[model samples]
Target chain A: HVTEAVHEYSIAHSTPLPEVVEQHRARSIDFANRVGMDPGMMVNTLQAQFMLFLAKLIGAKKVLEVGTFTGYSALAWAEAIKGQEGAKLVCCDIPGPHTEFAKATLLEAGFLNKLVTFFEGDGVETLQSLPVDQFDIIFLDANKDGYLPALKTILSRNLLSARGIVVADNALKQGLVADATDKNPHAANSNPGGVMGYEHIDEFNKFVRDNEQLEQVLLPAFDGLNIIRLKQ
Target chain B: HVTEAVHEYSIAHSTPLPEVVEQHRARSIDFANRVGMDPGMMVNTLQAQFMLFLAKLIGAKKVLEVGTFTGYSALAWAEAIKGQEGAKLVCCDIPGPHTEFAKATLLEAGFLNKLVTFFEGDGVETLQSLPVDQFDIIFLDANKDGYLPALKTILSRNLLSARGIVVADNALKQGLVADATDKNPHAANSNPGGVMGYEHIDEFNKFVRDNEQLEQVLLPAFDGLNIIRLKQ
Candidate 1:
């Protein structure tokens, strides 16, 4: 009953998103509509702000993003690292309308490949082929099914910098991951375009929970964000 | 319709709270019943975890707390600083049942009076009497109206370590702060309880938003938490 009001309360109280980010978000939303994709995939403004603050709070210099949808989140990360002359963000996403839109929006955000280097391939393959430089922050937002594999790959390959943080967006899929009964339409493949083909997101959620090398907490806000701190 | 589901999803996905913290939380709820007060003032486990990660992320060696309701949050901070033998947490709260409950819980957590030093009296006066020291983190969970004044005190006093963070619980005030309209029941005076006396929390939210020395984000989840990073 009071749920929506409570959610809106926090959003209204937050410092509004920067003009640059909001503009990029608008462009992404427009592009998503044109391409008939879910605009919800775009990083919400508060999430963008949180990620930006976190990156700066830790002095993150190198950022790796698995999903570059419209580049909203990457742009946010770039904003945080702007003062550093050499800070870089390596983004990986498949060649598609989403990334194409991301290219256009990144340009609009005044970063247009400046601090960002967009890879043109699947996240797993792109990450595997890259030179081994440690990443201070590694964000996972692509293909929900790949969360576990992507995380395992990130850790097993020593891609995270010392004291690095790994953030996974949409760790909870509309509460379906928590309670995937017949009542939860999101758990069904036919509902809402098989978002990530309705993979067992719960499994990925569990791996992060049980991993010995990681200490994690899921910020149960905004589609369920999983914030994991690498103990190593 | 999906709002509650989303919130629950995140909470469910989170790593469950340990027995020590849970025991404290349970005790607080029970104590709140005895005191005829709202139990929601206790920091939720997810928020607790986030605070712990943040403190450790900045390698916090000193923490300051403005409210010590049963000492739940202080314990959370202590858990984060477990290995840092010299780390200290200074807490200020009035002498009352809450502080008494906190003392008992702290002892029950196997950390009675360890790493934590409680100051009894008014928050403002208590803070004023303390020696000026840069804290890696300063948390506010006191009177609602105290948000701005407390923040001003913390900032003017330079009470934050370099890369320090200031966190205020209930920055959202049940969504009423965002829109103090008569139609919004939570915005009305006859609501659950005025944790901070509903002292225009939106204004406090706005001050944090507008302040230059502070870069802040109001997380709309979990009753609206505002996290501010001191730029200096």
Candidate 2:
């Protein structure tokens, strides 16, 4: 029940995507189609605007994105950081043709700088292996259930810089993350797994809310986004 | 249309509103109900978290709000500015019992001080009359159609500081701003006035996009928010 027409209109009213962004997004979609994978992993382009906006808001010089599915979001951060000298973006995803495809897209976008590092392994492993402990922003968009562990590791490792923020995508998991009942439209129409798929996001959301060092805002837009700013 | 249950669950996961915020919101709702006016003018509480998050992200010290409805948004801006020494928030709205109610809420929140000022007059006039030449942020939640004039006034007054932002609420106008067709759910079910109500927002959204002096992103979240960052 996304009400497709209204959503289409919302996207239309916002800033239209740049040619590079649109090209990269289309490349990812075509790759997903060929691989028989879910294109839903590619975030909506409207959300790309939100990320770009957030990056500027924080004056982020460095951004880390877990889940570099074809690099749509990675390119977004890169675009956001453009004109900032020595800015960097690190993306982590398992080594695969898809990962290589994303790299190619980044290259095509002309954002393939000396600083854009790709970790070709488990996102968590990459997270642990990063040489730097400070990132202005860490974006979690990998496996949904892995978020809790990632959160714990980020906190334990003290990976975020002062005033840094952590953004978790799909925190709503198609509204099923909130309304777990079978009667909900997303739950009834597609989520045959009941609430199992979104349990981790639910846990992560609560952890963000309950944590003393973090202040969280769960935005109910496009599958939900958790904007968690560290109080420390 | 908001799918109240899922939305409530989403809000439940976000940071819980403070007692003062909750009290003001409740009071506003009660007054709206009593008067048979739409309390829908009041923003959803979840957006309060976003506002607070943005305020901190920018380290905002001075905020200018063009619409001070029962003061929910004004109080939100006030709460966001807390702990910053000498931070100020100026609100503009027509004089009425609603504005009076908002004043009382600010008084109760203990945020009324030399820093907080209220302008009881037309929003644009107040904008032109402001003594300050700059602010960290300017928020527009006033009359929907007045946004163009308000934008002109803010820019002519040079009210926004460097790297400052302008957030206009209801930029989507319940999706009608995006889609005005009878096929759209909101337009068909609720809006009998065609797209007349949101013409200003529609124009403003386009103006933000087409204008070279600003870079804009229209976030299709809680009633839609237009984040306009001054390029100058």
Candidate 3:
């Protein structure tokens, strides 16, 4: 009965913390509205806070964020690494309205020195310019389509610390990833956007499974966050 | 088009590395068959590997496991903490056929002292016997109904390290969780067992939300694993 209860508890209340995050979406939403930018459907604040806490727990000093929409995620990370000696956050983003807002807010947060590097322009190019094995923690919130490329680039350049952990946003498209390949008779409508199309998260899940360089778990919080830790 | 390919690739690949243990699974399966067991569960293998890797990466020395089914999970933690002096594992279980097998294997693996201690009989009672602040990692794979109670006992007793990690398995229940709660009509039959009474996971998830002392992530891997790390 008790074992059954535990299983029941899990099924009944799966997204425990995310519900609170859903309630606390005001700050991010307001910030997005004022800056005339969308939050790019990324991680929620509570989720961001938890991640930053994880980064600090692991003693992360040098961090990399591929996208900088209003700098919320960047600020969360900066808060953790702020007072540490030689701590820094390297943010990559093309010049945009949100990037401008992010720059101002992060500066006001007094994290400018600790979270100041900006790789303006193409993320792939910017990632290439960085020295090898530099970042202790990397956040992949860039173009969803670029998730694999950016990851390959990071791996090839040896940008991640041997113990580095990377978190990718929106790895699952709602429940769209439930079906492995969706090749049934209704497969066409099942996958409206085709194999590599937009309205799907299967491709991403498969990529994570196929890659033999890292270990990852997909969390169903704030759309779907993939928590990946580099094995090497 | 290139972006689409990138997107598809992102889902198609990830950072998981080749596991050295996969090659041995068939052998393990044969051993299990000869010894009369299910070779454990495939999902549990993935969960065990992931948890062991994390524990090692975090420099965990003291660990606790609630279940000792065939000693597979215990072996995982042992492997991670093998070389470290003073590293230990505390396992709680009722005497079973797998118990003898576990003892022989662990002792043969040269973990006689390191792999010391197994509390037979009531697991909850055995857990209470551990000295406070003694564990850096705790794995919950015992009786399902005991999850919440075990969580309370471990946290209350302070057996967990200050910066410790707790991973609870089988929280997803083959997607049956939603049915018990009636959150989604589509997922109505998910929870055939009503033991999920009072929406336990929701209560747990919400507890994590308001509690700033811990950072948690619920991952959908091998039925579902909830990772809770103490915040500091």
DockQ of each: 0.48, 0.56, 0.23
lDDT by residue (tens digit), candidate 1, A1-232: 4556655555555556667877878877888899999888877777887788788888898999998887888788887787686788898898988888888777766676788888989898887888888898999999877777888888878899878888888877667665566677765643423547434467777787777788777777677778887773
- Residues B1-232, candidate 1: write the lDDT tens digits: 4556555555555555556776777878888998987788778777776777777777888898998877888888877776686788888888988888887767666665677778888887777678999888888888776667777787788787878888888776766664557666765563433546555467787787677777777787677778887774
Ten-residue segment with the worst summed lDDT in candidate 2 chain A?
A: A187-196
Q: Which parts of model 2 are misplaced by more than 4 Å?
A: A108-110, A188-196, B34-37, B188-196
lDDT minimum window of 10 residues, candidate 3 chain A: A11-20
Q: Can you tell me which runs of candidate 1 are displaced by over 4 Å?
A: A1-18, A104-114, A182-198, B1-12, B34-38, B107-114, B188-195
Name model 3 segments beyond 4 Å from true. Answer: A1-40, A44-50, A130-133, A144-158, A168-232, B1-43, B104-116, B131-133, B171-213, B220-222
TM-score of 1: 0.89
Candidate 1 chain B: 10-residue stretch with minimal lDDT: B190-199
Q: Whose TM-score is higher: candidate 1's or candidate 2's?
A: 2
- Local accuracy of candidate 2 as per-residue lDDT tens digits, B48-91: 86787788778898999988889898887887887788799998
lDDT: which candidate is best?
A: 2
Candidate 3 Cα lDDT to native: 0.64
TM-score-wise, the better of 2 and 3 is: 2
The TM-scores that each candidate's chain B achieves against the reference are 0.87, 0.91, 0.75
User: Of the pair 1 and 3, which is ahead by TM-score?
Assistant: 1
Top TM-score prediction, candidate number: 2
